[model samples]
Target: MMTTIVDLMVFIIGASIGSFLNVLIDRLPKEENINGRSHCDHCGK
Candidate 1:
């Protein structure tokens, strides 16, 4: 039971990190700022 709980916690943390990396991967190629409100890709609104 303890192992199951630990596994779940690890998975959640890892998934959060993976999600963050995914966002960086998506934005970095376009030279977008890593922090700030979202903007329109074409209009820059």
Candidate 2:
């Protein structure tokens, strides 16, 4: 049971980190300022 809980925590952390990296990968190509606020591509905010 303890091992199962630890495994779940690890999976959650890995998924969160992967999602953050995915955002960086998606934004870096078209961005002139990496620090700038992100907006939706379709809305053009």
Candidate 3:
């Protein structure tokens, strides 16, 4: 039971990190300023 709980915690942490990275990947190409708010490359809003 303890092993299963540990595994679940690890899985949740990994998934959360993966999702955050995905957002960066999606916005990187379009956004010029990575440090600031994520927006479109063309609009530059």
Model 1 clash count equals 0
lDDT of all predictions, in order shown? 0.90, 0.83, 0.79
Pairs of colliding residues, candidate 1 = none
With a 3 Å backbone cut-off (N, CA, C), the pairs that clash in candidate 3 are none
TM-score of 1: 0.74
Report the lDDT tens digits of candidate 2 across residue range 1-45. Answer: 999999999999999999878778887786645566777789979
lDDT of 3: 0.79
**What's the CA RMSD for each of the models?**
2.0, 2.1, 3.4
Assess every candidate by TM-score.
0.74, 0.72, 0.66
The segments of candidate 2 whose C-alpha lies over 4 angstroms from its true place after superposition are 32-38
Sequence-dependent TM-score of model 2: 0.72
Better by lDDT, candidate 3 or 1? 1
Please give the distance, in angstroms, between residue 33's alpha carbon in candidate 2 and its true position after superposition.
5.7
Residue 15's lDDT in candidate 3: 100
Which residue runs of candidate 1 sit more than 4 Å off their true CA positions? Answer: 38-45
Regions more than 4 Å wrong, model 3:
32-45
